[model samples]
Target: MNTTSKSKADTIAKLREKILLMQGFKPAGAMHKRITGLMPVEQAFPNQVFPLGAVHEMISEGPEGAAACGGFLGGLLGTLMADAGICLWISNSRSLFPPALELFGASPHRIIFADLQREKDVLWATEEALKCEGLAAVVTELNNITFAQSRRLQLVVEKSHVTAFIWRKDPVYLSNTTAVARWKIAPAPSISEPGLPGVGFPHWQVELLKVRNGIPGSWEVTWSEGRFHTHDETVRKLVSVRNDVQKTG
Candidate 1:
């Protein structure tokens, strides 16, 4: 290559690096990387992985599915809390027992749980909590969030650089949003421990239905040893592309 051509390429590379940093991406080798809660998931995006500083939507079709979603979120929270920051969890009502999170390395003391009964209150509280850059992450459970509402949440997260997790329970309908990714999780059969009579660890089928700047994929993930380990299930992925109450009952 000519000297002038090489110089142009270097200039372009530098500009891209600066743009990625402005977009909240961290330098990862010659490419930019986003700190998604899951490592395998981070790899799925290639150059544009899911970013924690954006809203992520999760939905399940039935009660069992909801259980799986909740289980996965627990592990997600564990990953984010490694930096020792406060996390806000806003929901219309409590579903899972607080003690269950102990296995995921998140002590109940580190979480601020708020019960917002009204739908409006839940949305308002979620938005407010996400705007606080001091918090590590914000999780909220709601029935519906339109595209406009989700865009608003995204704006706040972008400015504050905070992650937002939205759990939609028994949603009436599913639609696109400004979230970096949308997921659907269903409970898979538990893996039995060797030489034990009882079940070993909780497992779930995770389908990344939609990811704005990453690949969509599916995997069987299990929670054991305080972290998520994806089974060698031949990660089904693509380039681009809800629930009932009584989730665990």
Candidate 2:
């Protein structure tokens, strides 16, 4: 490339980084600081990294779907809080079981749960929590959120650099919002070891429905050993068989 072309390219690259930073993502150079267990899934994002300090919307249709979504978020929270960080969870319904978080590697004590009486109260608490730079992340449950409300949350996080996750269980309407990404998580059959007893690890069909400046895709993932794993049927079967043979021998 010519010198003038190279100079222009560098300027454009820097501009893109600045834009992403404003949108709550670190630049390409800082890709190492990303949520773990999101391997190929992260490739769909701009610079192959998930955006922190922004709002992420997750939708679920039924009770089972909501449970799966909560479990998945818990798994991510485990990593986010690995550094002794604190998180706030605001919800009116109080469907999430705080004790269950231990299965996903997050200590229930590290998350402060705000069980409000009204949805508006949940939203209010979420916004306030997002504005707190001392918090690592904020998660709120609501049936719907207006674009303006989401935009305000986005602005708060941009300045505070705190990540926010919005879980909409059985939402009446899915409207346009300022959320950086939209996800849908559904319950999938748990993988069981051969010759073993009852249920196994939690599994989910994870879908990235939409992302700003990124690709949308679907993936089957499981929460095993306290982390997210891109589920592979073949690998599971082989491991199960191998373990069973060893037990028999």
The numbered model that scores best in TM-score is 2
lDDT per residue for candidate 1 within 144-191, as digits (tens), equals 999999989988887888889998887898877888778888887666
> How high is the lDDT of residue 160 in model 2?
86
**What is the C-alpha local distance difference test score of candidate 2?**
0.84
Query: Over the stretch 34-56, how does candidate 2's per-residue lDDT look in tens digits?
Result: 55677868887887877777789
Clashes of 2: 0
**Candidate 1 wrongly placed segments (more than 4 Å):** 1-24, 29-37, 46-50, 233-249
The residue-level lDDT of candidate 2 at 111 comes to 96
Residue 1 C-alpha lDDT in model 2: 61
- Those runs of model 2 whose alpha carbons end farther than 4 Å from true positions after fitting are 1-22, 28-32, 232-249
**Candidate 1, TM-score vs. the true structure?**
0.80
Candidate 2 colliding pairs: none
